[model samples]
Target: MKKTLILLSALTLMVSCMSKEEKMKEAEADGNEAIAVKSKLIEGAGKALQEQGKAAAKSASKGVGDVIKGINSGMSESISQSDVIPEASFKANFEECKAEKIYASNDDKVKKVTIYLIAKNDFKGDLILKAFNADKKEIGRSRLKADIKKDDAQYVDFTFDERTHLLQTEYFTIK
Candidate 1:
């Protein structure tokens, strides 16, 4: 009976001592597995961020392109016309004043009509400009006060505040 008890004690001591090494090895394996999972998660997150950045850049590029197209179309819609409709007041001063150049143009969506005149007599009054469409309907009007002497050349600018976007000003009149 004493020999049996000694044998059981030795067996228990051996098992207890071996369990420490086994536990250490298992813990090391668990740590390596956790590191691998973390590395995979980081790589996946990096890939997702890269894809998101690429998509954002593509969308911004498209937005800029659309804005450029809009600007180009707006620029193409600008107008410049030299045709002028003669009125009775204009004919009465034909010998005293000569209309050299007359044109209407648009800049930044604003309409501007200009008239270059050579005066052969002394004049001091307001110059009125009336813009019209194809049907001869008055669309806009502008007035400028000016004082001029004989044999003087002057440039007059008239700006339209309303209906600035319409390029249908086929003709205009001066008074």
Candidate 2:
């Protein structure tokens, strides 16, 4: 028993001692260094969940933009009958506003529509929310009402039947 205890003691000593706190601190330091390196390599990757989120956001933004462009171009090519759609300008503006402004979505499942827009005071301007069906017919319209000062953000929300909504457009003007 004494010899066995002695062997066990030797093995324990051979495995260097590190407190949990100390190990965690060292790990955190290494993690910070890794984050710095990754930031330099991918730029925006260092944001919060450095590994998963930033890339996803950038990719999604690009994809959505491309889709919107395609839609606008397609619309302009076939929409000669409509004098109201600003075709080119509106397409660019929609993507730009989406990238610049932060908006939230509220879904009306029963109505089969999702309304997304910058809320009242998102900007010192009149914000228009327009919903269209797949047939390119207007289904709903609302103007955001709120007092927003310079550099202030706004919360916008609207609801319609999800089934009826096909393409949504937002128009904003600064007053």
Output the number of the lDDT-best candidate. 1
lDDT of all predictions, in order shown? 0.69, 0.48
Tell me how candidate 1 scores on lDDT.
0.69
Stretches off by above 4 angstroms in model 1 are 1-78, 94-109
Q: How big is the positional error of residue 84 in model 1, measured in Å on the Cα after superposition?
A: 1.7
Clashes of 1: 0
Per-residue lDDT tens digits for candidate 1, residues 44-111, read 98899798978988999999999999988666434444466656765454333322223344345555
Candidate 2 per-residue C-alpha lDDT over 18-137 given as tens digits, one digit per residue, 9 for 90 to 100: 778889999999999998888786665345457777788899999999999999988753432112332443333332232122223554243221222332223344445455445555
True lDDT of residue 142, candidate 2: 46
Single out the weakest 10-residue window by summed lDDT for candidate 2.
94-103
Error of 1 at 144 (Å): 0.7
